[model samples]
Target: MSSQPVQGLPILPGSTFRDPTKTAFHRSQTLSYKNGFAFKQTPTVGIGGTRLYVNQLSQAELDELSNKRPTLTYGQPKQAPPSDFIPAHVAFDKKVLKFDGYFQEDVPISTEEHFRIRQVGIYYYLEDDSMSVMEPIVENSGMPQGKLIKRQRLPKNDCGDHYHWKDLNRGINITIYGKTFRIVDCDAFTETFLQSQGIELNPPEKMIFDPYTELRNMPLRMYVTPSDFDQLKQFLTFDRMVSLGFVALVLHRILSQRTFPSCVLEISDQEVLEWFTSKDFAVGKSTTLLGRSFFIYNCDEFTRQYYQDKFGITDFQPVNIKKQPPEEIKQIIPPYNGYGFLEDSLQNCFSLIPQPPRKNIIKMLENDRKVLRYAVRLESPRPEDEKRQFILSYCLATDMISIYEPPVRNSGIIGGKFLGKTRVPKPGSSTENPVYYEPSDFTVGAMVEVFSHRFIIVDVDEYVMNYIEHNLESFPASVVESMRNHFAPRKAAKEALKK
Candidate 1:
């Protein structure tokens, strides 16, 4: 047969050979070792007769190569979960945003001495979205491809008085980052997902539980300014990736660095006298327990015992009594009833700075100095016109800005509950300021320290009314008059216009 080049054979391109025998192998190796006939060195042949001839790769050979493949170590970075992981509380409040309004309640007292009987509750949407104040650790286990949606479950308890919206559809279904969660079924998942997220399922044994804790689980009254309202809203939407555990963190920031200490003892001359004379002495025995820190002398048996157990009796005793104080009791100060205030302070103070590994005390102080609002004063009465200064400053600074109308003034103290149709004591009046009562032990709402100025609005009604009436009253008289006019004109027509 006439010589004809194998038609389908891949032409052996010219190549320099280390050895002509090896040249065929080199060509095959470059082609990942395709089976082919080997060539031998021959200096006389054109370019030393080295050539490649293809052959079928057998199934058995392919199987052996596949089995011998080397293991690969993949090195890829991890990714985090989708961004819209919102808490249930936040979603519900946002869903019911439009239903907020002013509401008042009437409370009847069966006392021989009676006063203004109106119990006021101002209703409005305050953002209650549960959100993580702390940012989550971005890790690779979760895929970030999808969106996030938050669901809020309604309270199972009789939260009617505290909740503004009590409709059947009280639950919230919200979309965030392309994921949707049903809140009614959410708390159940807290045990699982939260655990996976590094949260321990069991509360620590040392997590002091008081028999009276149930008593203290009262509804917290909150008053928010327009500025604060805006802040809370921003925290809910943009910061939805945060978890519920972080709320404590946010609260700690507000509580820790507020401009005012948690408690203030404005002692009157009589209070100082009562302290020395009373069997169970107190410097300001009758002073309202309004703020968080409460004082108990070492004399009380129950309190002393409690402290002894918590901090050990020797540590609880005078400092000189111990050789080396137990570190636990050295800082074993009882958890203040107002501990929430301190936690809130720390939470809020930290919020102003950026994320984790909290700033050192010096750095925090430096930042506070730059942002002076968080610097609440902690002080004792000074010799220079202390009482007079305190009263005047309190009058000017306290959030209670309502002009005292005589009947309301006569019946109750500034922050006291109002009894219907009764006279209130005048400021600086001789008569003891009528004993004010709380329907519930007061709760701190939100505290803000701006510059060196600090104001905390605990209950919404008085603070909101005071701020709005004073700050926003400059609208045109014509506008105000027209609004009133529209409402007063034939009821049906006005109603129709509203509809």
Candidate 2:
């Protein structure tokens, strides 16, 4: 068989290197030499007879080829240290944005004993003599969005009795902001007077008793206009409105009546002393008339006489003394010396009154027992393919649960090297155990799987035991024993390795 031409050999065209001159003709030859110097000055023959040469040298010749002198050395230019400066814009981020320095500190207003009405904004008077106040409803841009609404006004009727008049006059002094204004007239006159002063007929603000503001310790005098005095006759025909200060004076007078019965004459000389005392007046200790002094007994007869001469008053009115108790008093008080009256009345009247039951702490605990401690075994046969015991504890006050795990030791499989000689427990093996612990303070619930058996933990420890005993009384003894065994402490958990 003919051998195939050698693959990858370059094929030359016919007569490509042909030359007619015999001088260009040359035969190919191979030369072999043991030393490199044998091929030195060898000539190559082709179009030009260029001489081919090679150099043979020792280690000393190679050493002389490189420069021996040291290169010119120059030190690097010196540089200054970097600056620690920061721009203002860059530093502004560190500042707090409280606007604390720009605003003034607030000063609290006093409100003790005195009723203070907080006026948030301006109160506008309506065309019909009625007043309205504005309350902000929504914010549009930066401005308040609201409408003027009418305020409730006192009734203009004269149907209220002495008790109602007393209540209306008890709050004698009304304070707006820090300033105080006396209630010198009944609600009717006071309402009209307020309107005359250009004050809104209906106060639009919240009127409340200031806990911090207190009434002045000294007694105050009240002055009424002549027109108001004339108008008062139509409103308080049977009784008079008084200030809290005057009521206190009246109480003092009543307490010391035996010693200073004549003191009423002095009071009468200064102002009219009405014998009818209203319950409202007794409660508020406020009065309409302003008198200079509460100790009327201190005034001499001359002063009383001078006041009497000036006001055209001659003598004081006598107080009414009743000979027998009123019908109402007799109804409230039982008859005397009646047979079995006290016992029969107590049985019929007081027996129906309800008494609140006392709290039972033990029953409360039993009814609302919370889980304190719980443990659950978390396992996955694939993916992670590992097992871990999770313990949870509940916080009663905060309503939060905290989780804890057992301390783990490296099983000598760190960094892909088995440095430890101890063998680790296989996954899902009975030898895989968790550390034992006492019941925690509180826990809500837990779901656990132990030994391939599932359990839902609604309660734990004594709570769980008590629930099982009470609620599951019908359960078989074996079933109850199994549940108890599941919650029991593990004795082998303390060991490092399993047999």
Candidate 3:
């Protein structure tokens, strides 16, 4: 019934006892589950019985043994199988988190060694959170090197928690067992794994160089001189987008004012070394490269130190940096060479190709090819010049003028184009920025200059009088009044003829 034995009788180790109430006998199961670690067993004086129901049981489990129902395993899906319950190592399988680390071991007795920096690979088994540290074996090394720490779940504190991958990072000091290991770096997988877990690793530090290890490794090391050809090839093919391309520009400036590989390719490596050693490069002086000027206002500490070492010059005063003035964008509009309006020519300039000469559609349609001819005479002292009449025709569509000399029977002057179809600039104005003649400039008795030749407007055509009268606002008030005064007698005669 209970664990109590008969009075003064000791329970044998292998003996089984019967529960007096239930008449059921039980035997001991296996003693320990694990091999060495965490394996503990309590010796029972009595043997096995039916598994004690913790809280409650199903109706199938409470039934008689002879009852043939499927074995009802309450919480079987949630709980581990009785025979297959093991640690998390089975679930994690073959994944190992590795890190590269080193520890400084003090050397108290040896005269040759002050301290020893031993490199070790830290492997953490993700399965069971167990870890092992191993040092690589060196050929002919006198000191014993191999497995430094065995694989086991290392306890972090007395609370029974173990060291996890979360506790390790680059450039951090972690105490494994008693030895303090400085985590300097890690493999690619470990870095990726830590990052994937949302852990930010510190910047990786360089491992301390060990003189003792260096001496042991000197025999196996091979040194080679760097070739100049590779450097020259790299210099020739360097991308110009990055900041280091400034060096190429500087070099091109050092040789002469030209661009790129051509400027630098002419000089040999020996010449380049000489140029670097030369005293030409200095602060406050501007250098022109790639058609652009750059001022060397200041130098970095390394550059100053290099110059100081090479030339024994120490006075490296920083030249004051001046902010460059912003460039002003000026639009130089070309003079409108024959136009309907200046704005239309500018729009043509913005177009992809040259367009047909622009015309004000409304104005052009209204006064297409309409010409206003005026008879003007040259104001010259010569007797024949005052008598010679020139016909000045002004096209209303484009404000362009053409002059013709009519054939005279005995004037002895050839009648031809006195002026081509072009705009004539007004007098007293420079050729570059000039104002041209308009319809208002050709009023009767008015003096107009056409290329330094002055002419007095004698008379205007009948159409010019009618057109000007129709569009009164298009001309100046004074010109309108003068035209009406010059033509009043002709207008009265025409009106009297009509009556």
Candidate 4:
């Protein structure tokens, strides 16, 4: 047959077996004026195709779509009163009666399979009186499972009557397709429905597990050990005032945490009042609370007094706190760079201005003109320089050192002001930190080096000797002892002359 449309008829060149049109085209499908769909869907048939698409319409569905009613043969259909014609099944659509059941399967091949009990869930729809059975999918069960019975009306036997929701009850046997399922328990709706029907169901039964299943679900043996944790150092370092583990019971969420403390207490007020005030909480008594243990070795004096007054309990030993780590000392002030005194360096660190360090005005006023003087002889290669005398004066107020030479008779050397007043650092001192000479360095028999010339101190003035004796505490012990030794014989000679 050629695939082409008939000429001027608006009919298609296809016909189904039910509605055929003289082997050419169906005339009923060609009626464009009948308000039918203008564009007809073409069938998915190609050249030399063997299979055809079948329309999945039943005779009842076709009759309903065509608005045709079945002819009544059994005495005229009786019409009930409109008030009593209420349909219940339609109103309870999708309501299903669920049950827990299991069936025993016989395995003849293996010893363990001689009896296998497989648990299943059964559901019966109330509206349609249809039922379905489902076997729970087990991991690596090595058996095909799930949907053992699809939802459909099942026959009571080989008869026309099907299984109804009324036939299902807990702790009963439901045989579908020759396999019997023992219903153990049912859901709430099923129980309520059964009771409404005046049928008392058997008490819910537990599922029977075979030996293999029970062995598989058995819990394994285990050994647990307490964990070792250290936080005393951290506790002492961060919050030193936390007296004991009791502090953590309040602040550290001790009730919620799962760690093993010495003794743990819940945060509830009732439990606190019941457990905390007992004699078990007294000093020297050990008590275990929640999951931890605590020893009340000691309490504060106030707490001890309260316990003594209230409970007549005494004898509290002190708790050892040596485990608390020492407080770490941080470097608060930076090191001195040796450019100036420590106070001058500290003042500079605070401000950007390069100001002079604050002076001691009282000390400057008291010792402005006070100077320590010593007679010195310069060591030179020329023999005449050995007799030359030099005076080295150290000013106490400004820490300035000056040198002067006395005019000698018949000496070729002119000696007015030998060295101007300036701070003289010791030989090999850095220029950045010129360590000026101080009064402690001006002593009789001491050596002074200036401008590459070495001079030996020959003597000091009477005022200098008196000052050194008065301020022996300021000098080194060796220098003080030597000065004391030199004055001892003089003091003895003065006493002998008086005698």
Deviation in angstroms for 356 in model 3? Answer: 10
Our model 4 lands, by Cα RMSD against the true structure, at: 33.3
- List RMSD in Å for every model shown: 39.3, 37.0, 28.8, 33.3
Give one digit per residue, the lDDT tens place, for model 4 in 28-136: 3322433665644334443343233456565567777565343343444668766755466977787888999999988888866577899999988877778899999
Clash count in backbone of candidate 4: 1
TM-score of each: 0.12, 0.16, 0.37, 0.28
Off by over 4 Å in 4: 1-358, 486-499
| lDDT tens per residue, model 1, 293-380 | 4333123344344335544543323122223655663423233243322323345444566344343576455434221011112122
Each model's lDDT comes to 0.30, 0.36, 0.74, 0.69
Candidate 4 achieves a global lDDT of: 0.69
Better of 1 and 3 by lDDT: 3
Q: What value does the lDDT take at residue 485 in candidate 4?
A: 65
What's the ranking of the predictions by lDDT, best on top?
3, 4, 2, 1
TM-score of 4: 0.28
